[model samples]
Target chain A: MRNQHQNGTNHQVRHYQALSPAQINRFGLVELGSSGPLYRFCVRLFGILALLGIVGFMMRVASSGFSDRAAWGYYVATVVFIFVTFQAAPTVAFAIRAAKGHWRRPVSRIAELFAVVGVLNLILLLPVLFLIPPITGGRKTFWFELHWLLPFSAPGFFLFFGMLALVVCGLCLLYLSALPDFAAARDAKGGIYTGLARGWVGSQRQWKMLKSGLNLLGAFYLMTFVLVTTLFAWDVSETLVPGWKDAIYPAFHSITGLQGAIASTILALGIARKFGGLKNHLHMEQFWGLSKPLLATSLLWFYMGWSTFLTYWYGRTLAEQHVLQLLMFGPYFTVFVMSFLLKFLIPLLFLIWNRVRMSIMGPVLIALSILTGDIFEMVRLYVGPFTITEVGHEMTHVPAAHLPDFADILIIAGAISGAIFIYLVSSKIIPRISLWDMKEGMLLTRVQSFHRAEVLVIGKPE
Target chain B: MVDKSILGLFKDPDSTADAVDSLRKAGFGNHTFDILSGVPYPEGTFGEHGPGHKLFVFPLIGAICGFSVALLLTLGTQVSFPMVQGGKPLIAIPPMMVIMYEGTMLGAILFTVLGVLFESRLPRPGVGLYDTRITEGFIGLLVSCPEEKIGAAEQALRGAGAEDIKTESASGGGR
Candidate 1:
């Protein structure tokens, strides 16, 4: 034990060796540049595969476009995905850290940005819809063929741009507002994407550009975040039979999208931490902060589910009743049940416990389960819309027809992959950890005597 | 003339900072003297010199501008669009609050990072003399005394428990 000289009080003076700034090691961020060739090949391979897959999918959609044979699968799958996105896996937690105090760093910032980026899918839907009119030979496709979707065909000032602008604006704003972050990245070295971020000076003039870009984008998020849900809801309903109406559609769509966004971000982070090899810097603390949002988003979604279901239970009308009955007892029933139990119940019961959340593997498993459950929910909702097959003596309605073909899965995969690839690839080029914050931590930091000055940590409020 | 210059033995930082506070009562020249500590010891702890520059002020100003810009973007620009949404007002204050909050915080944090970086022209590297041991938790004393009394100053530092007293030739002073 070291000797301590004492004052009149019970305290003793202890000599401490101080750190010199000259001692600070200039640590270079580990470049993920090595993985570039492999990642690029994967991306290019996906593009070729997507192109080849598109042909078969186009032929199927073209064949199925006008046939009276009902196509309920899209609605069913989307519903399930939506349910999980909102209800089950709203955010993913990182492993091996205190889940409570994770929000103080950069992880949550990215998760929030992921939620914002999720709007891209909404914008992508428009071109798909616009293409639908031409693809179906000017006749009513699944959406227009149905009576429920006729409202979309009705006159409204913003039938097209209203939907498009919201998402376009939101994405533009989010991406643009990230200019400072881009400048941060630009300052860093290595990787394929680093040079692209080069001209971003964090100068006042450049900030003016950011301000303008964000203003345009912020206005977009305000309108599009809500309306994107409306568009998706309308599109889904239009695919169903003549009169399937569910007021809970938008709520379902919004929450599910949110859930998927969170799950996507979490799973992506998990994978990126491994593949991108950012484990040392990204840390468990960040993962835990991200998980809090995941937990919260799911809770909000469960409530939304009850709201959607309670209405169906109360509405005793024939069409609504039949749709509800079909969902509860018909082919969609099993998936519906599975989604309910797995997405809401399992995560709710398990995640709320502190011990489960602290474990790294637990959250990844939960996110995966929620993802499967989401797909189940999507199948339940979309497949039912197609289950409008007239009850017949000879034919049994084959439910597999409603399932997503390999093409749908691939394109959707590609769409999501492209967005995430941008993030993963960009990180290598720039420093992921805030250098300024680190320096600030060093410069402005004050360490006080704690427990006899044994712990030299940043000063905290007593 | 035979003499012993009682200096230059071990490279030890004179951390007798506790004694510096008592110098006023001991009748030393009260002309604003500063104590340079090895670690970032607080000002009151050893009567050390505060940070050389008031760099934190720029970040605060930047934060205010950020807050103002966010509000201007939300409330100011919404006026330009003026397209009513779901019967919501043209200048929706509630939504503006979210933008303002995020923007203000972002501005504050970013400005803080930039302020620190600018204040210390770090990462723009050109090496000079430094004791690596100082970085490895060794305290270092950096001080200035009257040019004429440097000999007396050297003696005073040795008497005050300084080790390995040596002068560093100041060169390439660019930050």
Candidate 2:
């Protein structure tokens, strides 16, 4: 409703009420402390579900044990689902901030807050490290049978440490970005904020270091994210399915992560605006701004998926056919159809329309669709390979799809709920809206009259 | 003579910028004063000299060190154990490249964090001559001058419409 169309130009006038620095600080700090009944209920609900997820994890361990790799298919899918969705969320902040997109100011903190979910994912990943067969088992691995002096499993070692690096980098990124806000809180509340602030004085040197640090860390986070995704895709999924040797799989998996990151950010933005008392900060522009990328990634998701599918479709080798059957046409055919439709077909059809892409609810609904599709997609990619017991260069047989039991269902729900729980708790600690960024945006933006209509003028300071 | 740290708080950014100009006109050098705000105002918004940092150097150094270390580890392991698999050389370049890449990134990331902390002078033992109001939309122009020049610094700050001024003795330190 705040968006106004200008004559001849397609630029819609974005209505922004400039909050003063004092006002920005006050609102941000107050929001950090204020939990409405709905907020409290959601927190408690997610908390219980998160505990249930732990119980579900234990139930899974007790029943299947670490040795039964096939039984843990759903659990592996759940972990990768969290990785590709929630753990990938901070990259949204990193990307937008690196691009210097002014519209990303309010959304950056929301995306970065998802870094807290990495702690949950890291813990979830521990069991999965054990789930993966060691590289010494004569399986195809990146390690290439070089397991001479290594005491532990090579893939597990690299995967665990790679994930550890990513998680630590994500947390550091979150903390450094929030340091100034912590200082603001220290000034206002002065209890825990004092310690968190770490005596930030906002000197010119500190600000400079902060900016440079954010850029450097953002770049490192992205590189690390891609590498870790590649490792996970190759070691965990691709190697398990014999003759499924597509070099593009890791790249495709990373693309899926990028898409999931955008979807998760958009969905969280919608929820924050609708329920988290941030309606004033989040608006149509944020949704519309993100929708373009959502559309691009959707098309990209199809592009990558189709490229890989076309290879198997034409190769027609017995191994390729079995690989396809295992993943696409065999036991998981329905799941594949659903994932393909939701992830690609529906998004491409819906997002192609400008009306749908520009509206707030349209993109939010599409993001939800993509997120749901991601779960099925993860299941298709991960669970199917996990069901395969073969360890050679060719697949002799396509195994039947493994269906999820009660514990598997609980694990899926609990992992998602646990991620949300961590994000909610983190929001209370770090201001959901980036206070300093908002204030800086206020300094750099203003509305000026242009030819009988007011247009927003933004200052790009080097 | 012991120096004094004087903090001039201004409600308006224009006044803060004016205070910078006034401090210069009052014979205070650029290094004697620095601007502090909750917002990261662009460099030179207050007409102050932009400070140079060695942050970029840190990552380069880290990368070199990391690459060197990774090179030694990968090359050393392959040379010591000299095993040929699938007709590939003992030191397989592709797998070594992956580990080396991770190593380089790890080094760059670790050093970048350390560089930021070191350059920012964070976790400072004490926050001297600070006002909470600076975080509440106020601008602080902190000036370090000899004890005798504190009066003139106060004059310059007040002349530029500083809302409040605080002064404390210091044993000659630069922020």
Pick the lDDT winner.
2
- How far in Å is the alpha carbon of B43 misplaced in model 1? 22
Worst 10 residues of 2 chain A by lDDT: A1-10
Docking class of 1: incorrect
**Cα lDDT of model 1 by residue, A65-105, tens digit:** 53423442452344334323521221321111123231233
Complex DockQ, candidate 2: 0.69
TM-score for each model? 0.54, 0.95
Docking class of 2: medium
Interface RMSD of 1: 13.2
- For model 1 chain A, the run of ten residues with the poorest summed lDDT: A88-97
| Candidate 1 TM-score, C-alpha based | 0.54
Candidate with best DockQ:
2
